[model samples]
Target: MRNSMHHQAGFSLIARVLHWLMALMVITMLFVGAGMVATVSERHAWLLQLHKPLGITILLLVIVRIGVRWAHGTPPLPSDLPLWQRLAAKLSHLALYALMLAMPLIGWTMESAGGYPVILFDGVTLPALVEASPGLYSTLRFMHTWLAYTLFLIVQLHLAAALFHVLVRRDSVMPSMSTGPLPGAKRSKG
Candidate 1:
């Protein structure tokens, strides 16, 4: 009973940890990406090294996060949230998940098309997933940039929504993901 209560109150421990860890990682990746494109210094190479591995790490974590979400499921929204808001929540979450999967793949493909190898860490390299071509590289790079900007916007929307829940709404929405026990651990109303 005590065990179940904790699990029901919020996201699983693993889920919470992954959510925050990935959140920080994604945000950092965004900044690193921006810095890489905005600079022309030797540090640019340093940023690229960090960005590629970080993106790949995120790519892998998101896969595990999806699996956790699938196996454990999400907590309910505030019971009183409007239908439109609820729909928006669903759509936005879908967009987030899609972007999480797409962005890294696009980055990887862009590197591959540019005839560059992605080193995961310590001389470990990920295989190139596409044929090398400067033309293909340019297209992939453009697509990656646009998708990244889209991700940035979507991330802002997500943050705003979370803040709304924490401040104005004063609901359990953010707590479900941020702090508390697993989502389904709470006892039933009956």
Candidate 2:
């Protein structure tokens, strides 16, 4: 029997690199974010300071990833996959990107409300998005934290779906993401 599984021309090398890099950054942010909330001390302050820079870096990388995705179309899903699964796949990805964008802005807004200068790696400082206010600071901080939990759940779902595709379906969904090619899909030469 001919394999219905087609390898999609997966993401380019640039996209793969950016994907892994952003993955690392996001994972680190999750840990750092949790630590920042859980602890109250000199260590917490140091970690909290790392949050802004890391968030901004992810923001910039995400922008680039979006651009690259647009420039180069993504590979098609496996033919055997049901329509509902395809739709869910698309929506899940959309949610991931939305959360990726939202988290950083939420952090920035919270910091702006807290009345602190957003220092970059060192020496560099970012202008405040808005004037500092006690009420807004508290509100944004709460939003950032709650949305983080939501993002966490969504990420777990995403991972589970990928594993499902790989193990049960024996599809290329997971590999397409990891290596940028699905079964029977052509690799982009560009």
Candidate 3:
């Protein structure tokens, strides 16, 4: 009789790298954004410089990440996970990808409306997405800030869920995102 279990490898190397890289970039951007709003000092300008290019870079990487995700479908959740967890996981991931794409775009539009160019690394400038307008800038700035905070909250929740999976359930979800071999892929015969 054949065993019911199967061995499934973890995510591909490219997906793992992109996941970690985006995670780091998102965390750093959140901190820098907080700092940018907290102070009126010259450091704000420096942070803005970092923020613009970083946002642009994230935009580019996310575009590539989408392609990678399309080519390599997401790893499946464990079969035993509860319905609520599976639902939450799916919805939360969708939200994350949407926010990751939206925040940078909103910021770009905001800057464009504010008459600021997205000067990327080494003076690589991105064209404006919209005509400069003070009122439009205000609206986009508000939406961007609101979305950033929402993204931050959702990211915290995602992190908490990952920790719960690792520490509480001790599941394979967390391991699947890493560079190492998938744990417990081989099931022992009864």
Alpha-carbon RMSD to native, per candidate:
4.1, 4.7, 4.3
Residue 157, model 3: Cα distance from true site in angstroms:
0.5
Sorting all predicted structures by TM-score, with the top scorer first, yields 3, 1, 2
Which stretch of 10 consecutive residues in model 1 shows the poorest summed lDDT? 1-10
Using lDDT, give the best candidate's number.
1
TM-score of each: 0.89, 0.87, 0.90
- Residue 44 lDDT in candidate 3: 96
State the TM-score for model 2: 0.87
Q: Put down candidate 1 lDDT per residue, 1-190, tens digits, no spaces.
A: 1222233557778989998999899899988999998989987989988998899889999999999988777666656789999989989988999999999999999999999977877879999999899999999999999988998999999999999988999777777787774345354321
- What residue runs in model 2 are displaced by over 4 Å at the alpha carbon? 1-8, 187-190
Full candidate order by lDDT, most accurate first? 1, 3, 2
lDDT (10s digit) by residue, model 3, range 118-166: 7876768899999999999999999998889999999999999999989
Candidate scoring better on lDDT of 2 and 3:
3
Candidate 1 lDDT (Cα, 0 to 1): 0.85
What stretches of model 3 exceed 4 Å from their correct place?
1-7, 180-183, 186-190
